[model samples]
Target chain A: MKSKTIKASATATLINELDKALSDGFKPTLAIIFSSIKQDWKAVCNMLDERNIKVFGATTAGEFIDGDIEEGSIVVMLLDMNTAYFKLEFLETSEKTTFEDAKKLGSIGKKTFSNPAFILATGGIFIDGEHVIDGITEGFGSEVTVFGGMAGDDLIAEKPIVFTNNKSKDNAIVALIIDKDKIDVRGIASCGWEAIGTTKTVTKSEGNIVYTIDDKPALDTLMKYLGVEVKLDETQEIVAFLNSWYYPLQLERENGDTVIRATRFANQKERSLICTGSVAQGSKIKFSLPPDFDAIETVVSECKSIKDNPEQQADALIMFSCVSRHLSFGALMQEEIEQVQNIWNAPMVGFFTYGEYGRSKIGNNEFHNNACCVVALKEKA
Target chain B: MNQNLQTILDFIQQSKHLSEDEKATLTKAAKDADKALTISEFKLVRTEKVKRTTAILLEETIEELEHKRKAIEDSNNALQKSLKELKATQSQLIQSEKMASLGELTAGIAHEIQNPLNFVNNFSEVSKELLEEMQEELEEGNLEDVKEIANDVIQNLEKILHHGQRADGIVKGMLMHSRSNSGEKESVDINNLVDEYLRLAYHGLRSKDKSFNAKLETNYDDSIKTVNVVPQDIGRVVLNLITNAFYAVNEKNLLQETQGDKYEPTVSVATNTMKNNIEISVKDNGNGIPQKALDKIFQPFFTTKPTGQGTGLGLSLSYDIVKAHNGELKVETKEGQGTKFIIKIPII
Candidate 1:
């Protein structure tokens, strides 16, 4: 397989770059696009559709290639692989039907390839990402290779979309199902945040809305307990979790592992915190301080775990990094992304997401928040 | 003698054994690695600051949670104490309701016993006179007069015995109502039970207010043999319903006094054997329960009477007592005409 990456702030400039790359007699079968909602993503799909290339696209908080990251721009990884080895499927769902929808798609992927690996991008504000994981596991009758991210609308936090040619929806999931026999797909989800303080119980919550923790208002308790100050916009609501990203809640799981939960929005009048995923009432949780530089090292090292040695190479890389990392690490996030890209030295395309779906180290596939998920793909034959 | 890599590079640069271009590339590579190391060092320093702040936060949060746990424990202790006090108060209120009903029955019971006692006294006085007459006749050798006097004394003795038993039954019934629940069920005659409460309730009211009078009527169901029930609890219920019926009629009677209407205050109590239960109903031809107060008629502490007249627990307690027997208590009322309370107890 051969791959090339192109990025531009405008759809026309992106098309020009595509034209320049195509003129060199490089024929591509698929285009993986990550872009800001401000860009005309519809035009990019049309251009790719004319070229008979399958498009699996999502709106992003920030889009990046190997060397640099940009806002309000488009990044594309054009791959010239055998069409028989891969299929792109797009599915839409209602508020209460995301699990069933993902299950149906999973079954379809199973039927498409004897041994299929799914690369997914989802779009929904309140969808429990774990349901999708569990549903797919049930539909396929077992767990398989699954890697994806929750779509973001450039920090607007309103309507993130996952689109294909001529179809896009805020409540939908787009999958890239590849036959693992023809292509090797391996990935890792890494979060190296250390938990601080004793665990506190969530006193009251429903779904993603946390009402209280330790019998006090959940929002106030989060601030007071952590001694962290969060800034509010003119409406007295935290804007896009920009200030509180550094102090995410680490959910203590029964298996002795922890998953991160980043507060995405707030209800000041209700005195509640709205999270990217559900925090069950009575579940124990601890506050996490910002990760050190080792966080990047861990991500790169774990990505290398899929390979036999450090010198092993990948044809292409796709990353689903939680947007909280961007807000927390600020400029330091670049070093992490660059390091992960260096491991494979491949043409890479990725976007910072609302949440991520992949497998953490030493676990089954999972839904994660405030973690970086890197997927490396290369043809086996 | 030194074959170290750094030493080799130094010797090459000093002896001019390597090209400047080669030396420049190696130097650039070394500088790039150093620059990467520098970036890592900077991130490490920043992370140390984060650790210090996080340490402080953890200490403060752990302290606060400990304090909250202590306060919650204290609050729980206080709540437990309050609960114990509340239980005591509830039982006291139940007893007070019982004593209040017993007080209402006291006057009626005394008057009822007085009637039987009067009969006994009259019969004894007559018997004494007859005995003196018999003695005078015997002194005159009149056998026929002595025999007639003896027969009269025997008849008086029988009447005295009948009245004495009637007084005893009233006292025993009064005692049953005032006693605490024995938690036992017994077969009791429904007609006799209703009759006893009807008379006791009426006479009690009359003793309290001489001007308050109401006509009483009864229909006893002869077919109702016996019902297995907690006798004291059921007696309390019957007494409460009859008393309420009397109060209703008297209330109407007082209103009628001003209107000068030809209203005859009547309270009718009856017992009947239904399909599988004995139904006792006390009906009053007086003002009924108001529409707004209908729902709350069986709620504790909800009184239709002015303060101190009723305990507001009569119907509520009656409802619970009937429920304990797996029975039903129902009320039917009209706005201005009347109200009828029905109690149905399963006949065993």
Candidate 2:
């Protein structure tokens, strides 16, 4: 099997990357991830239109796919898996999918696909990823594979976007069905950060704004843990210090140089910490600092093993990654992207996520805080 | 899934064409194909239609229940709001009544004081005139008229003291009524107390609103000697009624001013002695209470005054002051007619 890789720095650059991949006979099955910038959405959508590509993506706090974080880019990975049995249908209906709605929709989708199919969906407004899981569970009955993330808006993490093949919308949910006979998909989620330091409990918490932790103000707790004073006026510079090894607060990966586990949105006003996963009251939290050089090398080495596997030799691949890793590894994040490109030998596109969801290295549905999730889909044997 | 399966089977059956014998054989074959499927084809389809109809009915019932729940919640909120408004009105009415009674007592005291002062002014002028005339006669060689001059001086001095004492008596009466009249509760002889104040209050009113000609009547109870009361408070209540009677007559003068019709104003003071209590009333024939002002008359701070002349605290304070003594203060009045105030006190 032969593969192609597409790379772009910004959303405008995605069109050229796709054109190049398409020109190389890469019949692209598109997967995209994006952060919430009010601008560039329309431009990216138009570019996708000109390229005749169907988009499936969600608004995120930040996007990292295949290791690179696209601040304003729509990272599109185009794939061509020549399988006649696989059918792609874009379903767009106005009816809000309650449990009943999902059940109905699931039944319709199931009729078109065989047993052991994957139901990949993007959540609607105010819908949690759990609801999407629940809807798919009801519609297709208990015995179906379901996976997706609730959409996110930048660091605000408020309104989520559900991208259909046609356009981006706020109040819509989209599902992509993959039949078992058509594709064999394998998903793995991993991060390089290892839990270190003492634990901190979220003292005061609200939906996304966690104002304090450990009974102290959230910003104050972050400042104290990092040891160095950060000027809030220079947000990016202070955020750059998020992965500064001299004053690292995030938990580092014990096995690799993957993540620094950035404290994304901490609310000093409410005394709480809002990370990717569920942080309970009175739960202990520790910082994952930047990883060592050898750990970074180890992560690439492990991902290379996925390339060596006979089953993963797919015509295409899609990766979803956390954006905080880029700040932790700096230029090394680019190295991780290049490594995935060299090993997978396929068209790769993904966005940095606020949170990551994938099967663990041993295959269990897991919600990750700071990790990268790689899914390689190939023609079924 | 069930509906689709049924539709598919129906479609297959509708599409078939066969010879008469063949059709019969095929139909028989379809019936024996699967026992459960044969039963479902015959019985379950009809039952399923009924179930669908019932489900629609159930949906309607749920909607109706939700509507009723919302209506009940709205009514509860409305009822709570109205109850709060009612409580506020009751408290305001009670407070208003208290102040009105106090105003009436004050007006009575003012009228009582004014009467004696009018007499003092009238008599003092006469004394001044007599002393001047004596001085003139002495100046005209009346040195032998010393006895005459001394007699005149002593007579004038005695007249001054008489008028001075009358004014002092009226002031003392007011002070007694105004003092801690609510505190000193005692058994009072109702007939005696009413007769005394009626005489004093009437004479006092006649000195001021002189056009006030009310026929006074007394139906005093001789048997009921004493009742439980604060004497000073009881006296104040008597004074209030008498003063109100005189004012009612004065108001008639206003009607006379507009109509120019002669109407007689009469005040009747009566007391009935009972075995356990005594009832005293002061009735008047004049312009009575108007229908609109009736409800508000007993409310404090509510006045029909032109300002600077009256404080509307008479009847309300009287209601409380009377109620405090375990007695009733009642009124009977009609427009363009007359008014009567009846007070009943227990003989303990």
Candidate 3:
């Protein structure tokens, strides 16, 4: 197997670059695209289709190649793996149909490959990410392999689209199913944010909207603790943009691994907070402070430990990072990406996402927020 | 354990049917399998521990959520019996506004349905009495008086049928108002609804507290027959306002009795037809709301009443409901004299 990477800002550049890469008769059979929503994704899909490459594409908040991070650009990783060993599938989804659609995809993956490793990128605002993972696990009859990220539309939050060769949908899911026995798949999710306060009980919550924490209004409690003063008015739209992303709640799991849930928006009328993930009432949660630069070290080390290859080699690498990290770390986010990229010293393609999906440090396949998920693929020896 | 592998190796060594090359190959494969099995067992153990702990967390989370959900459903349904009984009124209020609207809805249904029913019963009895009078008049052979008596009986019977049909309309209208299309504005008899809920709120209070009693008054404009509005939404606001009036007066009655001062607890409701809009006002001769609290009365979860007694969502929702109709909700109050709440909706 062989892999090639390309980064382009225009369709003409993408086509020109593809012509140059194919000049050597590499003849790639699969193309994985991470592109900005501002780019013309349809044209890129058409060019790849002309080459007869199976396309697995998602719109990204930001994209990267190797050591450089680019915004509003296109990054492609072309693989020449046997198409017989993998299949690309796409489907539209809603709050009602997301689980069933994912379940069907899982069943299809099982039928296609005896040992399947599923990779996904979902698009939709109100989709419960955990349900996707759960449906796949149930349909496959057990956990085999699952990893992916939710799609993003830069910071607009309007529409994050996922596409195939000819069709595209904003509220949809795109998946890649690989024969894991043929292509050894390994990955890990790392969150280095540190908890700052004592655990508090969620007193009143329904779904992802929390009304209160520790017997006080959730918005007021967060404001007082964070020392923020915003007038409670009918039209106030305070949310993570006001530094809540830096201090998202750290959910303490009984498995001894803490996961994060970001409060994305607030309701001035109801005195509640809307979280990106659900926080069950009576669950113990604590505030988190953004990590120091050393957080990058934790991520890089975790990436290294997942290396099954004795030489720490990888044919292709992909990353799914939460967009909040980009917003909070600013330019420093590049440093973290560089360190993770250096671990395997291989061609890589990645994007900042709305949320991350991968196995935790405890090896539990779960959906995560404000996390960095890195996956490495290599064919068996 | 590795003991099984050691046992297998020992069996291979003792067998006589194997060549030296086969024995060497078998030994290496057995050792590799043993090593892989050990590592797999360790990973399996770790996975099982995490799964067990996660199961505990899931159980606790589900149990706690179920308990809270059930409690909220119960408190919300205490006064919403009539809503379910009139199941045809499937309002979208069942989602976020459900907790606030349920009790208020029953109060409206309870108060709105009672008026025409009382009239029906009274008219029925009157018709029966007039029937006996006609019989006597006919027996005396007074033809002129008999004819007058017969006309009176016919009038009584007509009144009975009118009241009976009115009762039926009230029931059907409520059912219609609760449907998913409850948001659409419909022509409704504002005076009839105001009058109905006023009595209904009083009876609801009386049934709860046998010792609680107050004077109820109505000053409805006869000319204002029907106003364009969503009947259920308007009914909720009116019922909340009237119910609060009764609560205030009852509180004052209790205080005045303890103070050894004579007091008359009166709650009066009036509907006025304005030039461009209609105004519904509820007044209570009890201790008025505080000046400081006037601004926050319409804010959700801000309550002047004691905890567990007031949800603090009633007035806030009432204010929103009125605004959704492009109307205004305002209050007039004196610290000790009284309070009046006025709601004005456009004529359209």
Top DockQ: which candidate number? 1
TM-score of each: 0.56, 0.40, 0.51
Candidate 3: segments with Cα more than 4 A from true spot? A228-242, B1-348
Give candidate 1's TM-score. Answer: 0.56
Identify the candidate with maximal TM-score. Answer: 1
* Model 2: per-residue Cα lDDT over A1-381, one tens digit each: 234544455665766676776775656444444545543666666666565555566676555545555564455554444434344443443323444555555786788776545424343333333344455567776656544444555544445565755666655555556666667765566666654444556566543334566576866656554443433443332232232222223422334322222444443334344443333444445654434534556666666655546344666666666655554454456667667656666656665554555554544344454566666667766
The DockQ score of candidate 2 comes to 0.00
In angstroms, the error of model 1 at A11 is 2.1
lDDT of the candidates, in the order given:
0.86, 0.58, 0.80
- Clashing residue pairs in all predictions, respectively, total 0, 43, 4
Reported per model, the fraction of native interface contacts reproduced equals 0.40, 0.00, 0.00
Superposed by TM-score, candidate 3 places the C-alpha of residue A358 at a distance from the truth, in angstroms, of 0.4
Work out how many backbone clashes candidate 1 has: 0
Q: How is the predicted docking of candidate 3 categorized under the CAPRI scheme?
A: incorrect
Query: In candidate 3, what are the lDDT values of residues B1-348, reduced to their tens digit?
Result: 499999999999998999999999999999988867865674465345435434544464466568679988997896488667555443333333444444444554555557767877787788788778878977888789878877887887787788778778766755654454447888999998787666656766675578988888889888888888888778778878988888898888899999999999998899998898899999999899998888899987788778876777778878988999999998999977889999999888
lDDT of 1 by residue, B1-348 (tens): 123545645654676666888887775665565556655665676677577667768787778879989999999999999999997886787788889999988998999999999999999999999999999999999999899999999999999999999899888877777777787999887788788777778888889998888888999989888889888788889889999988888889889889998899999999988898889999999999999999999999999899988889988988998999999999999988999999998876
The interface root-mean-square deviation of each model, in the order shown, is: 3.0, 30.7, 14.4
Better of 1 and 2 by DockQ: 1
**Which is the leading candidate under lDDT?**
1
Which CAPRI category fits model 1? incorrect
Worst 10 residues of 2 chain B by lDDT: B94-103
* C-alpha lDDT (0 to 100) for residue B103 of candidate 1: 95
